[model samples]
Target: MHKKKDNVFITGHRHPDTDSIASAIAYAHLKQELGVPAVACRLGGLNDETAYLLERFNLDKPVFLKDARASLDEIEMDQPITISLNASIKDAMDLIARNNRSLAVVDDRQRLIGMVTISNLAHIAMGDTAHTIDLLKRTPVSNIVRAIDGELVYESKTFDFNGKTSIATIAESKLKYYELKNRLVIIGDDIESQCEAIRKGAAALVTVWTEKISEEVIQLAKEFDCTIIKSTHGSMNTSRYLLFAPNVREVMTTELVYFNRNEFVDEVGRKMLETRFRAYPVVDDHDRLFGFVSRYHILNSHSKKLILVDHNEASQSVEGIETAEVLEIIDHHRIGDLSTNKPIYFRNEIIGSTASIITKMYQEHEIEIPKNIAAILLSALVSDTLNLKSPTTTPQDHIIAKKLEDISGLDRFEFAQEMYEATSNFKNKSYQEIINQDIKKFYLSNQEVMVSQVVIYHFEELDTIIDAFENEMDLFVERYNLDLLVVVFTSVVDNGSIVLASGKLENAVREAFPGEDRSFLENVVSRKNQIIPRLSTAISKYVG
Candidate 1:
């Protein structure tokens, strides 16, 4: 009874900061309050600062999502109305008709066995006359009785008949003309003839039309060790019902083409073409039934609805953002090359943090900002704006931070310092781990460039790992075949960045800023406002 429900996933960019995470969580709350089902998601693992904030607030972390690709799990596939292996073919057919499905998944012990279709049942039903009797041989006497509305006059609890079937239509003189040895004989209400057939070594005797056999005939059948079943159905109806008495396992297609719930719809769509089956069962890794997917479901596939926060670049977004429909974008960074097929609600500003934009939206929508949520938003604002010290901090960011601070009852500068200190523990972390903590890629002027940023209160902690940073940059450039790899070390005290460059753009970096081993740019703390545009122009001029 648990049906798959589609919830819109709201997430932020890779290497998400406190602002990115808080914005996603807050916006998901807003949407749900507006009667829209939504889930907060995180594209990357939580940073130390954000993790500290979440623990302080006792909030459940967002579910980690690797990509936004529309998969079969997101689509409304047919319900898994599975049939048991012991169920009759007639029951399978009825289930299919009632559920408006082409086939029914056969399961045994809660695991997938096979599938049965209407065509499979039809092929067995309309086959040779003897095939029906052959199939019904393995059927239990109880099943045959239920199929044809019969009752067992005399038989053990585990009675079964797997012998030939013959109707006693001919005269008692012609009973020898047909083989009755070890065979089941369907006879009418001829008491003398029934006794004669039972005497001729019949394995079972089926009396149709509520026939009453005399006590002498019953005694003779017991002497011959024969089974007796009485039914109200006529001869033809009894035979047809006997055809459906066999278990569904005997007719289901065992060699199957199936899909998993996590498989992408586009990938499954291609696999569906290799076979002639119209529907394929969706199973788990342990081969348990999940649901059924059809070609028509793929044709009418629904793309995932997403709300992107913090960053907008496709490289920084989830893995399959192109496969999803972007409903809105709330960010404070310079927009990258993220384009949509349709127009969306895009709110981009030059504020210090994405949390500021989300905070303004809360007021616009008249939604109350909870105390814990306000603390997180204020923490993100202080972290991103660097306690109103960074060059990217606007007047609006300061105002929003003050307002959120009053609501959260926390001191802005002291909290900001603690937040920065919480994430600045780089002693044990490797150079690769430190630089990749907040990295974004860009495709500018036909060149693939990667820019990584790390924030700290002071620069003395990184003096030991400067060589390691350069080595990691070289390795990254070689591994990814990138045109250039840049690492910006932003310091809160200096209010500037120490830029490190490798690859083809090393000379471009020197030309942009003529300096010593590490190029120093004044008031260049923000990658969005200062570093990106400067590097974009330098790379474009150098490459062109």
Candidate 2:
């Protein structure tokens, strides 16, 4: 599986239409053929017409991303270097030295428990008094032998050191005065002191620099139930090194600050500023360790790269478009409010659909267009031009549609009629679904307005669902905080539309059309040319 953050996404605007989706899919396929790591994405849910076309083509729905802001997953992070909870303090120091890191930690069941730093290790080593080694009694006897490189002379049974420890360098007679019962005694090659310690109930006996153990001393230690360890080093070094033999869990820091991979960059940065830690661990949703993230990684993060296909306005685009880098834009709509910091490849035209421009690009690159691509492209052209009936349909659109028809082996008129019939069947749909199937939001005269359009073969289909439409329109207006909500029911055969207007702007809609209840427009079909501009003008005049 590829990392999603590394892949470039080609997508369309919010509430995408057939042309918006088709052009994005076709362009993404073309780029992938030319060896670019690109995938098709959508910012919003699919409309009825777009969903129908995708189902006919056997294409998976594009990846949906609600926001485009940079996340922690996009930045490079440090690898996790962890040690077990039973590891020695010296082992933690060695690992940190080999990896060139400031700290090493301990874990249990894949969850971090503590951290072992240089300062903590030193405090444990030098901070010990005569009683500090008493804590080592809780540690395993095998760990002490390994830490000091010692061998058991008489007893090799597994056990823990749970007694006081002392250096028996005093007079052999004075050793009796000091309590040695259940205590660990460290002495140098002094056979008298070794025998004295084992006879007084010492838990373990460390004989420094001794290669051979006397048979009497071994027998005495066995009788006292004491473990006898023979060290290769002298007394001072053995005692000092024994402190490091305990587990690192005894010294690690349990309190820590960390982050997750899905957190936003800005929020994490704000949290990082509250502490002085050089780096922090990153975890997944299940609290499993992922890696480490540092301040440098956050400052040098990369932005998501994108190629817009149909629209460019911020209000019509994705939620976080301002944070992404727009490498190119291929649109056929009016240039709305969009700008960039540097020069980019921008192609905007007055053509009917974006599919026409993409088809021309395929010809210019001399790449063979696939049959599925041609079929979807032609469907988009027919839908946007309304079967060559809308005023926006140009000669170029006609020629390209005919060429695509030959490649797809499908008749244009039959396919268009079938697609419109399949998408316009509202028998099982709710009134809200019908109105929001292909809705667009716009701003006119500082007021938010919504325009929804649905095409049908005839007006008779509306007689069954007209009351439901008006009822849902009232709720839609209140829910969306819209000043006006207009649903344009256009007839494919008559080439005219009946406008249903509601909300606070009812007077503005009446001003736009003042005539009989069923007065039909002569040649008004395209919403871009005949509907939106006229409605904007009437609303402006009414508001003024």
TM-score of each: 0.91, 0.85
Candidate 2 CA-lDDT value: 0.80
Q: With candidate 2 superimposed using the best TM-score fit, by how many Å does residue 447's alpha carbon deviate from the native? A: 2.0
Backbone-clash count (model 2): 1
Best by lDDT: 1
lDDT of 1 by residue, 1-544 (tens): 2223467889998888788899999888888878778889998888777888999987779989877878888888887888888887777777877886755455555678888888788888778867776777787776777777788887633344554678888564756677787777888888877887878877778898754767887788777787888977999988777777788877888888888888988999999888877788998778788788889999998778899999888888998899888999998887677899999999999888988998898889999888898998898887777677777899998789888988888888787777777777686677777767787888878888888888887888778878877998899899889998888888877778799999988877776666887856777777877777878888789988
Total residue pair clashes for candidate 1: 0
RMSD (CA, angstroms), candidate 2: 3.8
User: Clash pairs of candidate 2?
Assistant: 137-161
Error of 2 at 303 (Å): 2.4
Error of 2 at 340 (Å): 1.4
